[model samples]
Target: MNRITITILVLSAAATACGTSRSATGGAREGSGTVTGIITLADEVSPKTGDFCSGLNVRVTPTGAPEDVLGNGTVRTSRSRCSYQIANLPSGGESLAFSVKLPAAWQCGNGATPTVTPEPQTLQLRDYQTETRDFRVSCTAPSAETSTATP
Candidate 1:
């Protein structure tokens, strides 16, 4: 092998090594997609204290594989809204499920347990696609009657 040919070969190998990194789960980083959305409280419900926006948790996993979490992010207060984004997901028209959980203190406006809309949403994600799925949480002020009731 001549010196020029050997140099070219080495450069090619180096480039390949640096191309298309891998994610934490050993998945190819290329062709990854992102999921982003906002979490909102129902219009008629509100909490007196604590930052509800910052207490929301979002999780992404491959559909039917709850144990394998692709990515997760906490919602942040963005301009009077709760927003979150889970990026770097392995996308190839694969089915992925997303779910959100609100803080325990929040209760449904109907005086029941709190619940979010579109729970455990599953959808096909394509490479380089950015999907948006918003969620609305129903919550109201803590029931004073229950809290004050004596045993």
Candidate 2:
């Protein structure tokens, strides 16, 4: 085989290996699942009642226990607007904690991400294949209450 052809083959092989590299963190795979629904307060007060909490954030953490923040991140919706709909999440056992957060208001010029850490909620999966986790935010403020509650 010509030297040019041999070099091309080696480069191609290297590129393929790099594309599918996996390290400590399980890189990537093909599995389908979903998490959708609106983020509403657990209290009887309707979200449409016009309140600061109406625009609250909904975040998901992959942890059965609320204390365990396996994977912490906020969901994306409209600009600066938060919603509860983490679509097509990775497939795994029920290991997520849902919470209603009041993230920092960027418009106010405060760079800090202000968050209202509600009681951690254990999510239940209908089916690992395709699940819908519709949860409610704990209306009872954590500060006012002493004992912690789980959802």
TM per candidate: 0.66, 0.40
Model 2 TM-score is 0.40
Top of the candidates by lDDT: 1
Give the per-residue lDDT of model 2 (tens digit) for 1-151.
6999999999999999999865322444212445665444333323233334444555555564444333223354432233555544445655556666553321221222233344446564443454444434333323444678787
> Candidate 1, after superposition: displacement of residue 138 in Å?
1.5
- What number of backbone clashes does candidate 2 have, counting pairs of residues 3 or more apart or in separate chains? 2
User: Which residue pairs collide in model 2, if any?
Assistant: 63-95, 104-114
lDDT for predicted candidate 1 compared with the true structure:
0.71
Per-residue lDDT of 14-99 in model 1, one digit per residue for the tens? 99988855565556433468888887777655563456666566878777787777853446776556888888876888777777
- Residue 20 of model 1: what lDDT? 57
lDDT of 1 at 56: 66
In order, what lDDT does every prediction score?
A: 0.71, 0.46
